[model samples]
Target: MKTEAVRLYGKKDLRLEEFELPPIKEDEILAKVICDSICMSSYKAATQGTDHKRIPDDVAENPIIIGHEFAGELVEVGAKWAGEFKVGDKFSIQPALNYADGPVGILSAPGYSYQYIGGDATYVIIPKEVMELGCLLPYKGEGFYPASLSEPLSCVIGAMHANYHTTPGSYVHKMEIVDGGKMAILAGVGPMGLAAINYALNREDRKPSLLVVTDIDQGRLDRAASLYSVDFAKSKGIDLRYVNTGAMDNVAADLKAITDGYGYDDVFVFAPVVPIIEQADEILAFDGCLNFFAGPGDSNFKAPLNFYKVHYEFTHLVGTSGGNMDDMKEALEMMSKGLDPAGLVTHIGGLDAVIDTTLRLPEIPGGKKLIYNHIRMPLTPISEFEEKGKTNPLFTELHEICQLHNGLWNLEAENLILEKWNKLT
Candidate 1:
């Protein structure tokens, strides 16, 4: 079968081309992609091309499709999965595949790199390795966009789930946040940061008694505060504060004042900036855990850490690139119960504009950029829906749907979007 996709040949070289896909093997499955969200990592792969750790060495010679966050419907299920997964079954993928048992096994390779097809294409074949690793998950969500978003949400969940311990003479490591402990999200208010905020507030396992979200951008900080209000946190019996550090004369001192000069129990750094990272380290409580959640494209990106704090106060740092299948499952379960991370989505477009969108993702201001593969529409910001509705009736309907859900994207909005522009077979 022939399909169109965005293929990466070399650094800063992305080609939108049509190619023929081989027949699915007996153990493989063929899926038709419905929604693919452009991620910052996709932009990194596009700019780095073959030099990227995830891109296979021979990608320049054999160009590969680039995308990982996507959702689709099964078009052809192999004999092995015929009964278990039939045609028309909707699904999402945990793209971090670990086929080999060794340390260096397929950690860099995901759904959208060399040897494996990605969701940028109209259809992709599910490799035997992916099925064997159980990375392909059956999605029962109302829409494909939400299923596609689960991958990013899982990364946020993984960061929160990461455990750390203190070495107080004994080798035993303590797990979870200290009960009713204080937490802070440094340089938060971005899409993933907002997800972390939601997970920190809503997770039943380790709920923070006090949560503070800090950002330099007042606009972003205000949006986060409006979405997750201090009043709402008070109702939940938790103290929540949104602060713009840029406005403060002494940011670190102000943050410490919130915790009564004791510092935060857990701190999450959402930006790759070294200054921000250092600031996160500066505001740690004794035996505090810092999670470097952002994935930087530069391999040599270095940040200074206080070894003194690590040895004396037991302050430690950890980083996670992506989540496992279990994290994805947990995110799906939470979303099913109306956690509504869909508010993280701020922009939407169609496959026709995906190539350009992927190339310019980092520069684009806003949250998730959802792309409908079968649809042919321009990139539309959610904030412009009401204005666009004046000229286009379709956008007017979308505006109405969003209004019903408190001006946020919901299943109704997704269904309305697909109902207007789903031309797939």
Candidate 2:
């Protein structure tokens, strides 16, 4: 079968090309991708090309498709998966595949230049390895875009689930967070940051009593506050605060005041900027856990840490690149129960615009840039929904649905979008 995809051949070399795909083997499944969300990691991979650790050494020899977060329907299921997974089954994927087991071990995932296909394509074959690793997940949700977001949301889930411990003059290490303690998320108004905030606020177990979200952009901060209101958090018996550190002359001082000088028990750094990392470290309490959640493209990216505090106060740091299958399952379950992360989507486009969208993801302001693989529309921002609605009746309906949800994307909005687009196509 012939299909279209955005393939990366080298550094800053991404091409939207049409290619023939071979028939799937008995253990493989063919999925018709509907929605693929552009991620910052994909942008990094596109810019770094073969230099990325995840990219295969033979990438130049075999250029690969380049997106990880996506959801679709099973167009063809192999005989082996007939009963287990049938054609028309809705699904998503946990791209972090750790298949190797012994001395010849190599830890890698299916996305980027390492795999034969990716989410950026109109269709992708779920290889035998992916099925064996159980990374291909069946999704039951109202919309495919929300399911596509599960990958990123799972990363946030894994970060929240990360545990740390202290040993008293001993080498033994333990894991877990300080229960009901103070937590802070730096640069917490972006796409993944918003997911973290939603999970932190809604997770029923071992949640923080006080959650402080900081961002340099007041607009993002305001949007986050509006989405997750103070009144709502108070009703849940939690203290939630959003602050724009840009307005404050001293960000560290302002953060310190928010915690009443006790410092944060758990601090999450959402941006790769070194200054943000240092600031996150500065606001840690005794035995505080600083999670460097963002992935940096630069291999030599380094930030100064207070080693004195590391030993004396027991402060430590950890980082996670992506989440596992379990984390993706949790995200799906939460979304099924009405925890919508679709609010993080700020721009929407079609497969035709994915290459440009991937190239300019960082420069484009907003949360996630959702791409409908079958559509051919230009990228549209949520903020311009009303204005766009004035001309396009489809967008007019979307505007109403989003406005009903406080200007945030929801299942109804996504369903409306898909339905309208299908009709036009």
Candidate 3:
């Protein structure tokens, strides 16, 4: 039926739109989306996108659905998978389906191909294959507040378990992941950077001798220090020293001042900002590691990374993108252990605020920005759009079209609107 979605229209226009949904197939589960966290990547989607990452041609032509991070509960299940779920089952969905065949990776098993699913909608249909691979997180009600955080944390897990992090963890030849002994979080304080910082503190191995998180933004730097738990040990009083890489000098010197005139052991660059990397390599200690955390566009963006430093210092450079199922499990495991996962869900609002929220996503003064979808829901597609926890609505012609449409809206149990529309059409 009718689902409220945040649609991307070309370069710089994103808005909330009403749309129809296909009925859940035999291998599908209808998820009633309750909460979704707008990631930093979602905020910068258009800016970072080139022709390659553009939405598929068929989806919207102009305004295709755009949200990809979300958490919700299963409301409907196909007969074959009925035993796997029950009503009121709370769950957080892993929306990145990059390695697949279908729009939502329904038909194709996951791989490195089709990467995303539209999450800013009233309902999301999970393919049977996704559920089959343990993608559907069953509700255990174990302090999982701010379930919106699962996706972000999952990405961290993906990075940690990758060849880069794991290689260091093996301890075979002194290679170890979670190099906490003298670690630094470059551009730390932003939402994604903050996530990296939190993940680092939780790791048992590689606890940093000096946990240095730097950011040019004073506000975010303040936010990072206020975390209290992660920085209680070695972080200086969270003062940001702005570096003008345009000067092309003193960048390494500044970092030296922070690290006892020796470069840091490891650095995690949260964004793909090039100049930061120019200076990052110079300041890293011999045998240091640099982890590029954010996912940049596919247009071959260039940076002045020093391969000489990479070779002579015995250093390494690595990057990570969206999280996998293992990452989701790592996030859920943190929740189960009673850690405050809700720190990630910093901002919360509703559908009526979608435009406002999206406009502010890039500048918001918080960590995890979440959109509560059930609020300000329109009644345009009554038959298909009606949900169990949805708010009551006032009907108009548009609302009527949304609600009464039998073809899309009255998906589950038929309603009056569906019957009337079906007979007329």
Candidate 4:
């Protein structure tokens, strides 16, 4: 058997490569790669080559697959894993795993050494370890449920769970409110910012009195215009929802305006640019929080610190980088509940579309663009555990477990054995 994969050969160059299939181990299942989204990490890797910050320094750039944000189904399941997960189960990709099995295990040993597998392919062999880390998603139809959004959403989940301040026993911030409170979003209204926006809006026991979104791009401001649904943008005023200063004038004035001249209570610096954080320093209220949502590893990525402002004004600083398995699970839970991952997905493409779509990250500002339907059209759709049980036995198990525990697992069927026939003469 063979598989087609989008392999990057050098800086800025990508190609579709074919590889021989490997035998699936008892704890491993074969997955047909279906959906994936282009990301800034992949784009920067192409532009910066091995200089890419997201890919670890020790890893080889070329001859590697390209996608990280994706979702897929189990096509083949190994027998030892038969009771572990079922076929036809769908889930978002949770790419991080920590192998602690004495460091000599075959399952994640190669991945730990080779820097993990990428998703720009026609097929992927899912070791039991990787499957255990994925999030099982809730579905509503034969249509792809957009579970491919797990990776980006997981990043939001991490930020939400990070350093939350509170009464010592409360969630993140013990204050228990945001969105409807005075909130400042720097470089806001882009897809990434939108995720933060919605998450802040929908936070339980934490309602923001005001939601202040800022962007120099008129287009982004225009898009932020629509976040006032019942579940998002709970603030009573749409006039205060978005603001545009074109990255030139003082954004402090706009944020101050939303906060009734007092400054916002919470500020989210969604863009990685230095100047934006500077402005966040200006308009954040005393004891307010400023979160650095964007991350850049450029040599010149340093931002001038206003330590005086941070200390005197009592502003809180926080940031989150990548998605982990636990974060992915939280994201899937929100998606399962019918919450929009906040229009953060701006583009959707197939495995063949990686290079083209990746190149557009800086230009495209918001939304977590999707890739499932484009790459995995040949896949049989699955919505019910009972449905998957007819063909692959693992479906019922994975589905029941997901519904009951709000988690995801990989379902597959595989045979990894080398049986000796009659003695050779």
| Model 2 residue 56 CA deviation in Å | 2.5
What lDDT tens digits, residue by residue, belong to model 2 across residues 331-352?
Answer: 9998878788867889888888
Alpha carbon deviation, residue 229, candidate 1 (Å): 2.2
Local distance difference test values of all predictions, in order: 0.82, 0.83, 0.58, 0.57
TM-score of each: 0.94, 0.94, 0.74, 0.74
The TM-score ranking, best first, is: 1, 2, 4, 3
User: Mind giving the per-residue lDDT tens digits that candidate 1 earns over 119-157?
Assistant: 677888887777787888988757777788888899988
Q: Candidate 1, overall lDDT?
A: 0.82
lDDT of 4 by residue, 1-425 (tens): 47777665556666666787678888777776565655666676656655553443334442556676666677878997677567887655565555444122322222122222466666777666665644333333222334665567677667655634433233355432244557667787765677776666655545566666778888767756654343344343423467776754566676576567787666778788888888887787766677787878576787766778665665677877766666676667666666655255444344455555566667654455454422422222123445755765544543464444322211111000001101110
In candidate 1 the C-alpha lDDT for residue 196 amounts to 85
Clash count list over all predictions: 0, 1, 30, 38
**Model 2, 395: alpha-carbon shift in Å?**
2.1
Please provide, for model 3 over 1-425, each residue's C-alpha lDDT reduced to its tens digit, 9 standing for 90 to 100: 56777766544566666767678888787777765666666656533332324344343353455565666778778887888787668887665544355543332222111222355667766666567667777645442234667677778656655524223334343444544446666676677766766776665544555676677666656545555344344353222232323343576687767777777766777767887776677777776767778666545877877788665556777777777776787777776665445445444455666656665565656566556566653212122233422443322332454334322211121122223322432
TM-score of 2: 0.94
Give the lowest summed-lDDT range of ten residues in model 2. Answer: 101-110
Off by over 4 Å in 4: 53-62, 98-116, 132-142, 166-180, 227-232, 235-240, 363-367, 372-425
Displacement of the residue 414 alpha carbon in candidate 2, Å: 2.3
Q: Candidates sorted by lDDT, descending order?
A: 2, 1, 3, 4
